[model samples]
Target: MQPRLNFYKASQEAYNAVKNLENYVQGCGLEPRHIHLIKLRASIINHCAYCIDMHVKESRHDGLSEQWINLMSAWEESPIYDDKERALLTWVDAVTRVADTHVPDSAYETLKAHFTEEDMVKITVAIGVINIWNRLCVGFRAMHPIDQPAKAA
Candidate 1:
């Protein structure tokens, strides 16, 4: 698909505001692993192919296994993730679908079981950032790179 426009060039100040939030998420002490997982899961739910592609590559570079990353699409049925990872995945799902789910209390309980209050807040912020990215990319039809031809891994 083609891009509608360059979101970064449209307004540098607006981009920087969101970028600063993203920077905070990066240093917020949430595990890089969990952060990557949250990103991929949210991108999937939002159906933002640009973000899904970008995050899959980034997650791999950060040392997540291809098997694990691939299974995120089917996380509910996958047995690969541990309890802590499972909790964050659940939180990602609920928050990403907040309009429909109302950010359910059960999801919060699951997350609290594994993470501290600070980490829960950080995770929510991380989820919110990715959703913002998904809206921007999908709304603009932002295209993923074509550095290599697509094929099965």
Candidate 2:
């Protein structure tokens, strides 16, 4: 699909603000894998193919297992995730769909079992950042780069 516009070039200051948030989220002490999972799952829910493709590549580069990546959309039924991971995923769903879920107490209670107050804030920030990115990418029709076959040596 053709892009609606080059968001970055169209508004450098705005893009830079988003980049700043990205930097903060990266340093917020959440595990790298958790960050990737949150980003990927939220992108899937938001139906942002560009963000989904980007996060999948990043996650793979960080050595996340293919099985885990494959299970992101149906994480509840996957055996690959632990209790903490499950809780985080649950939280992501609640917050990402906050308009509908209203981030119910049950979701908060489950998250509290696995994360401290500070960690909860960090996770929420991570979720918020990803949601913002998903909206921008999808709205702008950002396209993920097409994969090319490896060249013979």
Candidate 3:
């Protein structure tokens, strides 16, 4: 489905403002892979096929193996991810589906064990941003074709 508007093109200033957060998050010591994971999790929670397809493509560019990427939906049962990655995934799920799960103390403590305060803040911000983007894409019914590649960030 076509979007009601080309949000990126129609509002360059607003788009830049959001894009600028990427730079800020980068400064907070978040890895590119973690950022993509956050995006993928949020996309999955929001059921945004456009964002999922987009982030999956981006993740592949950053060297994420197809197995790991595909296993993200079943991360709990997958052996590919480590405890830190598992913790981050847990946080992503809680935050992305906040209304359903709420941000639990266990998840917070788990995340805190793996991430510094700065990293935690950055991760949360990353999660928040992706959730926002997911909502926008889902609400607008953004569509992606199977053969098309994601546009670069």
| Candidate 2 ranges with C-alpha deviation above 4 Å | 149-153
**Of 1 and 2, the candidate ranking higher by lDDT:** 2
Residue lDDT tens for model 3, 1-153? 567776787778877887788667766678888888888877887889999999999999989999989988888999899888999999999988888898999999999999999889889999987876777678767787678677899
Better of 1 and 3 by TM-score: 1
Worst-scoring 10-residue span by lDDT in model 1:
144-153
Best by lDDT: 2
**Total backbone collisions, model 3:** 0
True lDDT of residue 4, candidate 2: 100
For residues 39-115, write the lDDT of model 1, one tens digit per residue.
Answer: 99999999999999999999999889999999999998999999999999999999999889998889999999999
Would you estimate the TM-scores of all the predictions?
Answer: 0.95, 0.95, 0.87
Ranking by TM-score: 2, 1, 3
lDDT of 2: 0.95
Candidate 3 error regions (>4 Å): 148-153
The ten-residue window of minimal lDDT in model 2 covers 1-10
Clashing residue pairs, candidate 2? none
lDDT of 2 by residue, 1-153 (tens): 799998999999999999999999999899999999899999999999999999999999999999999899999998899999999999999999999999999999999999999999999999999998999899999999989989999
